[model samples]
Target: MRNMLPAAITAIMSLSVLAACGTAGNESGKPADSGNSSTAPAASSAAGAGGNASIKGKVTFLTNRTDMVDKEYKEYAKRFKEKYPNAEIEFEAVRDYDKTLKVRISSGDFPDIVLVPTIPNADLPKYFAPLDDLGLNDKIYFKDYKATGGKTYGIASGASTVGIVYNKKAFQAAGITAIPKTLDELYAAMDKLKAKGIVPLASNFKDKWPLQSWVYDLPPAIAGTANVANDRIKSDAPYTLDGAYAKSFGILKNLHQKGYLEPDINSTNWEQSKKDVASGKFAMYLLGNWVINQVIENGAKSEDIGFFPMPYDNSGKINSPLNPDWFYAVNKNSKNAETAKAFVKWMIEDSGFDKFAGFIPVLKDKQPELAQLTEFKSFNPTFIEGVPDNDQAIATQNKAQIDPPAMVQDFVLGDGKAVFDKFNKQWADAKKSLGY
Candidate 1:
């Protein structure tokens, strides 16, 4: 079992612009102008006067981070009890959380606080209570991640930048003096590592999602936009031979064809990948900073590991794509909606939980001191926002059977051309169904 949950940004030059409250972005990174203004009653911030009186009941906080159950949450629970002595909070942590959260929502038994459900933001009114008036909108780092219909639906728990996590010792052994600034250098460095009898990159293709992550990793560098997916949606043939989408996949194919990825990628495991990368058995893994602690926890010295943005093409400066991790939202159906909001507010504004978890705080002035993110601090790379799927597009995608992750797996295992051709057809059909 992969003990570490794969945590899943915007382009802002200044941290203030990054923290500004605004309209939410659709699944394609386009502004959600659905024209549906939120008429739902605004839930007052629990920090306001007389708010504590309504916050005494038990509030169930749900998250996918089972690893934090004994480590972080226990400490948080203790601190929360000190503040709200009468109120009780319980955590519901589980594996395969995205699927399970949907199951719970479908059953109408969802918890009070939801952590990054796979559901669309437009549909948030159905499941999560609004948090627009909580005074947290301007304080958050990624406004678009949870904004919908001009209302903030969820509060970002923390922030992270996607980059190439690697072993410094392995780089040294491979005679790599400086970090690669281009894809050519990266591939060359991988070749050197392979020659030194080290696994160049831990593909973790067997895990499916890791392989599927190329969609996230390659685009910011290739398209030079956070709204890459949305751009693809607008272009009739975004996956054409000369397009950035095709270029991104071509890089993946090159990596595999050159044997820079693990020899038997289909059998590779993520849990073991952490240990191997940490131990210098493997050189690198393209992942988010959220997995840095997991790599350290799996038995390697923190100093041994480092992170750098993916150097796709010959771009002089690496464009690091920043993103918010799990977002905490209050469930609309919760009996203790106010209390749940209070708990979430405490966690976001007061608890200082993000700092302890090695996360970049969502607040504007806050900066992540995480060792892996140290390299990016001075780089001043552009922060790219991720495109989110809208309800209609999501419904169309479901009907079209366009599974990018599964398609990625098929590309590697079977025929690449055939797989992408099917994908292009499905995506077109889905778009047509939505009258796009």
Candidate 2:
């Protein structure tokens, strides 16, 4: 689930104010030589407010989206250099980036500006530099997503909401009159779809990560609160049959029990399921708004694909989980601190990353033109506020070490009560090992 999984960091933050630092250049505009000398930014005294700060040094940017690297980010760099021409940006891709980043963090070998991962709110200060000092709070949206004690350490390029991606034509074919707004209504719609010989939901259990939608994505809508996940982490038996965790999982269990899921769920994969929904073989799938374009690109008619908030409660007021894919964080130990900070400021304030990245713009009055996101907003979904989970608490499951998705997959295979029981014990053990 990209929603909660720790992610790679993003760009921009300038160097500290220097009195008389000189502009330095390397052969071929590469990173300057680190001669164990002063690592402060080379800001010229001639530069003042609104004037270009002479920053020269290599800032390494690590990202998981190599596609964006050659396309969108290449443009971002060109615009960035318009101000600090001396700065050189070196790009690197760490495969399985989120997991590899953890290894790099443990080894003290992380890059200068990482695409900041879901490193949990409690651990933000340990790995990132606070951006509030740069006055980012008043400038950026969702500043509180990664803040603690009034210090903002991470800022997102954009935001996304977890919702159900469905085929609009399929609902019309099933003679369904309205979109579901509650768990009971969703089940009722499923019954209508099933009656007309259509799969009500697509569960890509073989890949497993998609199953995390039920665990982490759906519950916030059900509880009408974003704190459900963090709250469960602090609860005694998070997987009990009657708990909120179960209530959310209960939605999946009900789908399986009622024969509303796609056939042979355990063997299904995400790619084929995308086509299935496109072809009207499946009606809906639980995922973030990001998947809407992908589904359309996979040959689903763009107009036929619509997104709605996940309705897990009868409150008639559903809350879509708002998630920032990754935040741009400056590495505190970097030699080019001022330049890095400058880069961050440029990215947050000047770069048109939202349009290029196709995300919900986090800037004030800056709205996205993506129809899926616009459709989601039409529902007037409620937003939730909660603390970010520390790596120690969130890592075990997100890594698929304990594999909550696999457990849900087992529930699909059979014997859900046993699986929930086992999960409760394991979850408690994992949390206890972290002394919480």
Tell me the tens digit of each residue's lDDT in model 1 across 9-96: 2223254332332221111211122121122223565546654555677888988767667666776677667667778888888765
Residue pairs that clash (backbone atoms under 3 angstroms), model 1: 9-385, 10-384, 10-385, 27-387, 27-388, 27-389
lDDT of each: 0.68, 0.66
Candidate 2 Cα lDDT to native: 0.66
- Give candidate 1 misplaced runs (Cα > 4 Å): 1-47, 51-53, 235-238, 315-317, 377-380, 385-392
Q: Write the per-residue lDDT of candidate 2 for residues 1-436, one digit (tens) a residue.
A: 2333122111110111111112211111122222211223223221224345446677988876554555556766776676678787766765556667777876778988886664666776787777665555654566776677688777776766677889988899998889899878998999999999999998776767677777766666566666666666666466666665677677787898899987776688776887888888899988866566556655776678888888887878887676666777878788886667777766655664544444555554344545665566668766553335545557545432565666677765666688877777777776776677
- Compute each candidate's TM-score over C-alphas: 0.82, 0.73
Shift of residue 119 alpha carbon in model 2, Å: 4.1
Report the number of the highest-TM-score candidate: 1
Q: How close is candidate 2 to the true structure, as a TM-score?
A: 0.73
